[model samples]
Target: MSHNVLITGGSGYLGGDLLARMGAANLPPYRKLYASVRTAEQADGVRQYGAEPLFFNLKDESEIRTTVIDREITVVFYLIDAVQYEPPLFFIQALSEVKKATGRTVHFLHTTGAKLFSSHADAPTDRPLLDTDPQLYEIQKSQNPKLNVAREGVRTNCAVVEQAEKYGVRGYVFVPCIVYGKSKGFGEPVSTLRQIYMIVRAAKTLGRVYRVDSARPEWPVCHIADNTAAYIELLRKILTDENPSHGKNGYYLASSGSIAWDDLYDAIAAALVKRGVIADGSVTLASEKNVEDMGTALGVPKEMVPVQLGGKCTLSARRAREELGWKPAYPAEHILEAADGEVEWVLEHLRD
Candidate 1:
């Protein structure tokens, strides 16, 4: 019996990368991969990988049940955002439809972010968050308003996991931090790579560079290829019922390593210098006034100015390695190189 998999958000950056990897691996012989997209063009793009693309909105219950029910969708890879101060009830409803259709024995892979866990200056150094740690719940309660929505997501995910266990469905969630790689569609503009591109582009023309403050924090980062590999490994384990890591049904953070904002900025500057886009790495950190000026220059919102200047948020992926046997092939520098290549390609084709 061939395994059938349905992936939501198939036209996004991560989905595009996952589809590309599936094409490369050629695993799950006779795999019937279904991708849901918003537009006909996006559906066509997904079909290039030999996967069936279905046009359906995540919010439509009837559409979900109609498309997913009666289908032997043994595994599901959900990559929709339900947190980050966004409304994600539609995703929950869709998942409910899948649960209702599959009778809970289906393998559900939910994607989340590592930001669910919080950190503070007073925390003990040796008390890093563990899978069994219960402190995260408290920290989640005290998060900023923008992150309060994540608490609901976490609660919903926990409920789903519990329901899956109760109904004999296998569930797993992966929480990644700052995924970056070559993008294929209209990707979100606030990604780190996009910020880097804007800064590098500005530096090239303005003869000055922008750098974020180093003292803020370090962000955990992962390469798209590496992240995709982890997802594939998880999918294979679930579809085959192999209990790759002893049937652990909880959240796993996916990150290669952590890098300071200043370090990342320097790397992007170096890439721009290598490409001759900028004469030298003589860019200065954008002051508050410079940020406003640059926002106007770039035609982006001034409120997003601080995002480029923000520091990293740290996360650990040791659990992903120990449990799923996953490891990132490319480190931070290599990931930046991959992103720079993407920018260079875009510039070459888009340049008049």
Candidate 2:
């Protein structure tokens, strides 16, 4: 018998891409694929990918109870917003509901990010992050509130894992870096890359060239396609009961390659220049006067300016590779190339 898979946030970017991939792979053909969305319009869009759309607000208790009970969903891909709801409350409630309804072993895939492991204090300049490293875990416990939330997320994830083992459900958690690639709907905002592109364009328009410094820290990036591939592989293992050790309720960092931020900036600039969006490469970082400006320009906090400017965000994906047999098709540079293609396509199609 085929299992039913329910993907929360299915109408969103990552969910839509995952649905598209599942359709293409045709692996473990789910008896039913249910996607949760907030609006009828979003549900309509999700149907384009051949998924049955379920409109439900994640915060509503009745909706949650109704959906989980009604669907009898055996496998759930919880890819909802990380920053929106309070982690402890949101997760506890959702997990409780799912656990109550599905008495059988349910597979829960919780999505997280590498930033959850990052140090808020003047970012690390030394080496790439590792999953088993005690130091990384220690740093995660340090001063940052966001990291603290991440710690709770780990706890919540582990709780589900333990519950799965005790109650015969299977649960796994995924930690990914900046996920980028092509998709049907607008994915997470590409604010940082777009800012870099704009700065390059401005410099080129003035006929001045500025070179990006290579000494800046490297940011670990993964193509959305490759990230989704890892997810699919993990899901397949769960469905077949092939290797319970795969993902195994532990944290796995998903990164394709680590490229210095300055190098990324230069690449975006180069792409802009190639498209005649700018004449030269003289670009600079945006002034940090307002919080929104910082978020809009860099996709991070204003306080993190120094750390980001210091540029040392690098992570290792050896765990993902060895355990999950996952490999990113595009490296960091190539992913940027794909992103540039996305931008070019946007400009070409949207422009007059």
Candidate 3:
């Protein structure tokens, strides 16, 4: 049976690009493509891409149920909140009902961050954690983070898998890392890559870029195109009934490789200095006052400054390549090369 798909967060950086590229992806046959939008303007914006606009409050369980069941949306790409489990649970249950009524295999893909699998969440950082590891679900469940966001994210990811399994709905945990590059979408043209953007914003406010971690920790990075391609490839696999791994076995990390946060900081700092956004390109460890000031700039607590700006996430991207035949066009270090352009783009879009 042909699948009817619904993709959420159409107005977001990743979702808008996904929707913009969906029409040209040349995927296996599907019945229809729908994009969720919050406003009439966004609804009109998505129509240009041939996606029917789906209007509903994502937080309202009844609305989610009605929207998914009535439309028979077999595939859901949830690009919205990663820390919230309620909406995904609702979507999974709704998809299960749709499966019961039509006997069609339904899929729910949740877009979570690589941070949830990193040091902040107490995930193992001594070795590379492959996305396809058999014990990843257990690893995720074992994570006990003091950081509120990491704790919530870990709980949400596990809950999504557990709920999907209980309801017989195929679920995937899609992890996006420090994705950078120009966003090729009608909405939210600037990338919401907090790690990179935080450096620029905090620098502008503090008059310099500060490193929260004394040790140069490495994290995964991906280009915007490569990140979107991973999403499309997974969808392609699902539409063709290839039955790609789901539930606990379906962790897909969309990173080309890993880069040191120090390297990223230096690259972006040089770019800022060239633009005269900061006084110097020298990167320094954040003093207590600097972290507090940075926190004030980021509107997050001082403790969360490091969590948001710097951390070690050794989550490797093997499943997408091995399972979906996905190949990233850009390398991980490409973000460093693109730092100047990325800074300009982000600066142009920074409202505050």
lDDT of 1 by residue, 70-103 (tens): 5656567877663422223333344455667655
Candidate 2 TM-score versus the reference: 0.75
- Which pairs clash in the backbone of model 3? none
Best by lDDT: 3
What stretches of model 2 exceed 4 Å from their correct place?
84-103, 121-125, 132-169, 184-215, 243-249, 283-301, 304-311, 345-352
Report the Cα lDDT for residue 270, model 2.
Answer: 68
Candidate 3: where are CA atoms >4 Å away? none
**How does each model score on TM-score?**
0.75, 0.75, 0.99
lDDT of 1: 0.60
lDDT of 2 by residue, 26-102 (tens): 57656787888777787787777777888776777666756766676677787874434343233334444565765
Candidate 3 per-residue C-alpha lDDT over 1-352 given as tens digits, one digit per residue, 9 for 90 to 100: 4799999999899999998888789988889989999999999988998899989999999999999999999999999998986999999999999999999999999999998999999999999999999999999999999988889999999999999999999999999999888777888877555677888999999988888898989999999899999999999999999999998899999999999999999999999999998989999999999999998988889999888899899999999999999999999889889999989988998758
- The model with the greater TM-score, 2 or 3, is 3
Stretch of 10 with least lDDT, candidate 2: 186-195
